[model samples]
Target: MLRFENVSKVYDDGFQAVKSISFEIQQGEFLVLIGPSGSGKTTTMKMINRMEPHTSGTIYIDGKDNNTYNASELRRSIGYVIQQIGLFPHYTIEKNIAIVPQLKGWNPKEIKARVDELLELVGLNPEVFANRYPKELSGGQQQRIGIARALASNPDIILMDEPFSALDPITRDQLQGELITLHKKLNKTIVFVTHDMDEALKMGDRIAIMKDGKLLQLDTPEKLLHEPAHGFVEEFIGKHRIIQNPELMPVIDIMSETVVTSLPQRSPEKALALIRQRKITNLIVVDEENKLLGIVSAYDVIKQLNDIQTIDEVLLPAEPFLFDSATAKDAIIMMDESPYGMIPVVDERKKVVGLVTRGSLLSAMSSQWTDSEVAE
Candidate 1:
């Protein structure tokens, strides 16, 4: 829906903040701009609606040069959200949200309804918040109101500049998930800016990594992680490369380094709860010495619930089944046959090594496929 054609930005002082960069953003694609502090991502984004004019070349919104359209007309059709939110302190949330719709000459009834709908979409109770002023709301709530105001115009594209960067980590993650869900519903073309890698991976349809005044690499998260374009790209990704290890077989190789939660020998109820809580169907059986003895399955718990009040009845017989050095392909097949979502990785001694899951294995396989295509 948008295109940048060999665009460059040079300041009066002769600093080139954005070089001759070019890329296409498909309709409804969540394109993320990721890089360090001095990178040109913000500059590139501002040029879209001529917030900052390009020094040379063109920015085409739907195949027409941005310069050809009047600034007011162009901006009215686009949604914008920033890290600071920039809401009017004196205006009520409803009034703030109603700004664009009213400017667009929407009917009074329509504007009111839209305010309610957008507030609800952002998890705010319209009845309570519609009359509240910006100062009365929390920072996150104000940010949401800013987004509601952006969507009020029903724009075809949205420009978000570090919208969630000011929030706490947990709140940031929660909002990221909320944005991902909203994108599926709204399907508006989005240009997002962030330095957080996981956010780029989770939300970006394609990530465009930038350096000082230049575009570095534009690729899917899987491709970016598995097949970095250069040493710079590799260094940019950093320890996140550990997440894309295709050769690491079995779950044990990549399980969280923190101590595993253990199931008490006599707690059948705890075992059953753990199965659902961990989203895993199997529980590792261990003794007082912190040694792996056996494993328990949910089926085993349900089957002998009447005869046993404890996990001893469901505990593995003998050494139990061992999953040794299986490739991702082998693991997928084994998981398909067993009731467990994944089997524990073990060595020749049948000792616990690591863990893998059906979902994680599938993610690995996808990275392998995309990386192969990237190689070719």
Candidate 2:
């Protein structure tokens, strides 16, 4: 765990990067610091390792003041990864990763083991990459090695400063996926710094929004997207954030139960009647036991206007299903794959519970829109 109390920094040139800020980071929490350049995100993270001492206020690492430990000793316990992917050109990949272990006086065999463990952990094959120097590897490979190096000592804390910013879009995507997988497995208390809001939302367990050298808000990704604290935060969070947050609108929140019915037969007349009654383009159908059967669409019914039978005549099978608590974001993904106007929600028993529509999700988010008259 880490804590910062009333921390600030003012340079000799009269530039201030951070103002008095206080916050606590829980153990194993992936906290992201996000804001525009010069927002003091980098300065705040550096203060944790004592690389840049705070001009005022005290920082505690696991309850003890950070300043209490020797600078080098304190750094050894904190792993850092940066945009440049800094690596010693003279050292082999294995030697680069083993630097921290060697500094701690680990035996050669132990350090080698640590290097091997980290290489495989970061998705690199030690047998192939161990002997390669920094120049011998591609940019992404070098960055992966840097990560392995940082973890060599098994640090409880890891700081990442735009670690994937330098890579191509495809590589960046690949690495972000890898980092998510790695973080879940390692469970280190991570402090990630990024200027990109989308990246922050995807990676951060909670985001700390900063502006003008001060903390604006700290909340879960859902809260930040749904409710911006002030005009400053609204400006930083971007214009379409509300529309983008389908995760906050769960399917259970706005489902209509009265409109759903069970039927195995098909009838255009009945489907049209149901549409007119419910004021919807479709209706849900299920088995006698309440398990999901399929959906009856007005479009399909209208296509067969002369047909008359059970609703199954126009009913289209619902592709894949989700539970009630999977989050609105998950729904958006399913919808995108098939462009569903609405999707049925099923319970643990595979029985239809309700439904969620695109309009419902957007309207739920739109309710929190900020007044345009407010200042940023």
Candidate 3:
């Protein structure tokens, strides 16, 4: 829970780094600040932990003025991670992570437990990495350690300033995914700063676009993609960029309304016959009220035709289904885990409304590219 009220930062020589930006971050929200160099994105983040104090306006953390707390104490209470992971070369990974908790006067046993837990949380083996020095690890590992150290004290808020920009593309992508998982698992309010629009869209619950020391736009990734408020915002996030973000497309637009469904009580022979007649790969098994029960694949129905009395006996678990309100991105992500390359879309009452198959999903996404090309 952080709020900035027309916040500005001016240096002693009168260089205005931030120009009265006002925004509020909800609890457990992943808010990203993005802009080009000298755009005050970093300065805005620093002002949160009082690393660079704001020159004008008020900053409140947890409903209280940030200035009410001691600067050193405030810094210690919040987690901070940077692109250049500044881990001490001589200190062991365990010591580096334990610094924050140790300074907070946590007991040795608690600090050790916390360090080991954080190491595993960042996907590193504590037994192997805890005693190793920072230099002993690779760049990605060091960045992970930096993250672990930042999270050492289990702070409620974390500030990440281009934390993954320095890693290789593959590693950067991997770390981005890992950090996303961590954000959901930890549910900590994260203020991430990055210059990359792709990374911002992938990471942020809401993105704040800044330019020339002013806040230009602040909105959800979907809203920003569809309706950029400013000309500069549109230029910054190009048409191609908007097309690339699958979250912009509603799942309903790509899903098929003609879903082949069957009652769970249907005989295996009849269900197989229906599957063949309809040329459908899977049958959506439902109740008398049309609520989804499970899915029966044609392969399974044929295999178990003589072995089972009813189609329900060979039913596969209906998982990874999306609500009608979901997005194309949700379908895209869940498609891999879906059996038979199909995802059932359901309504508020758990009734099957539509289905998203691989074919339909691909077709919709391909059309986005075509549209982008035509617009260009």
Residue-level error in angstroms, candidate 1, position 235: 0.9
Give me candidate 3's TM-score against the actual structure: 0.70
Q: Which regions in candidate 3 have their CA more than 4 angstroms from the true location?
A: 239-376
lDDT string for model 1 (38-154, tens) is 899998998997889889988898889998989887887889999999998989999999988888899999999999999999988899999999999877778889888989989
How would you encode candidate 2's per-residue C-alpha lDDT over 1-376 as one tens digit per residue?
9999999988889788899999999999999999998889999998999888888888999999998999999999899999998899998998889888888899998988888888889877889999989999888789898788878899999999889898864346556756776887889999999998778876788999998889999998778867888788776765444544455666665454554565766466866776666566566788888888877665556646775466676667787556877676777677534333567888888888777664354444434445662343
- Residue-level lDDT tens digits of model 3 in 116-165: 89998987889999999988998888999999999998899999999999
Name the regions of candidate 2 deviating beyond 4 angstroms: 240-376
Q: Model 1: which ten-residue window has the lowest total lDDT? A: 252-261
Residue pair clashes in candidate 3: none
Give all TM-scores, in the order shown. Answer: 0.70, 0.69, 0.70
lDDT of 3 at 147: 94
Residue 260 error, candidate 1, Å: 10
Ranking by lDDT: 3, 2, 1
Q: Report the lDDT of model 1 for residue 354.
A: 65
Candidate 3: Cα lDDT at 156: 98
